[model samples]
Target: MLKDLLQTNASFEEELLEEINSLGKIVDFKSNDILIDLNEQIKGMPLLINGAIKILREDYNEGELLLYFLEKGDVCAMTMACCLGKKQSKIRAIAETDGQLIMIPISKMDEWLAKYPSWRKFVFESYNNRLDEMLFAIDNLAFNDMNQRVKNYLLDVATINKGRKIIKTHQEIANELNTSRVVISRILKALENDNILKLHRNEITIL
Candidate 1:
C-alpha cells in the first residue's frame, strides 16, 4: 500500500490501474530476478500484484542498503530512478518470492496521463511521497544514534510484517542502518543476551 499522502482531487490510483490493464501482459517473476537493472533503459513501470520486492543498492566496498520493501498492490513506476526519461535505475527491484506484476511502458504511461489528468496527479503524488521517504531515511542515518536507529528499523519492519520474526541478517541490518556489520552483530548479540530478541541464521525473532 502507498504509505504517504495523496492528492485529494485526483483519482490517480484508479486511472493508473486502468492504464496498466491496457498495456503488456502480466509477468511472473521468480525470487532474485532483476526486474530492472542499473543503467538500463526504462521499458515499463511495474505494478506489483503479489509477493514482495526488495528495493536496494550496493556499494563497491560496502554491502546493500535496503531502500524499501514493496508488497502486493504497490506501484514502483513513479520513482525518479525509474522515471521515463532516466537512463538507469537508481535502485534495484529484487523479488523476494514467486511473484506476478503488470508492466506498462513509460511511453504508454505518459500517453495515458495526457488523457487522464487524475493519473498525472497520482504519479506526481506517489513520486513526492517516495522522495520524502528517502530523505527521511537519509536524515535519520545522518543523525540518529546506532541503537535507536536499529530499534527504529526493527519497529518499522515489525509494523510491516505485523510481528517481529524479521528474516534478515546482521550484514543486511547493518547496511540498512548504514553502519558496520560488526557493530550490528555486536548490537544484535546484546539484544539477544537481554532477551529482547533471538537470532538464527538470518532471522531475528523479537521477544
Candidate 2:
C-alpha cells in the first residue's frame, strides 16, 4: 500500500519507491491533527495519501492563517527546506480531513536528492508549484475584499474536500482566512441570504 501510494507521484522510480517503502511509515490522522508546529525541530516530511492537510503561517501579532494545502500526492514545501537546512519549522501543519500520510525521515531526504535524479526533479518541481500557490495566496490577501476572500476560501475548501458540503466551524473558517469568528459568521450569513450557500450549525452547503 505504501509503495503504491509513492508510485502515484510518477516521478519516483521503482528503486526510490522501494527505498521509501523501507524508510517511511504510513500514519493515520484525524481531522484537526497537528502534524507539525511552529518552531519545532524538523524531523520528517509527510507525503499526503488520502486526505487534506492545511499548512498555516504563524504570526505573533496577527495569528495563524492558511498558507496553502497538501492534497493527495503532495508534500509540505516548507518541510523540504527545513529538512535540508537543519532549520526549525516556521509553519504549522494540521490535518483538515481524516487520512493517511507517509512520513519520510529527514535524514533520507538529502541522500535521496544526491542519489536519485527523479527525486531531485520531484523536489525542485514541488518547490516551483508551492511558490506559485504562495504567490496566489498573497495576491488574494492583497487585493481581494473580505467578502470575496471568504467566498474564495469556501470554494477552495469545497474543492479540496471534493464536495459541496463544507464541514467547518465559523472559528475554523476565520482562522483559515485570518479573521474573527464574528466576521466570518456575518459574511457567511450574508452569503447564505444571497443564495450562495446554506448554513447549518457547523457546516455550509454550497449552492
Candidate RMSDs in Å, in order, are 4.6, 1.2
The residue pairs found clashing in candidate 2 are none
lDDT of 2: 0.88
The lDDT per prediction is 0.69, 0.88
Candidate 2, after superposition: displacement of residue 110 in Å?
Answer: 1.6
TM-score of each: 0.78, 0.96
Give the per-residue lDDT of model 2 (tens digit) for 1-207. 566665456467779888888888889999989999889998898888889999999777858889898888888789989988989999999998999988899899989989999888888888988999999899999999999989888999899999999999999899888889999999999999999999998999999
* Candidate with best lDDT: 2
- Positional deviation of 200 in candidate 1, in angstroms? 2.4
- What TM-score does prediction 1 earn? 0.78
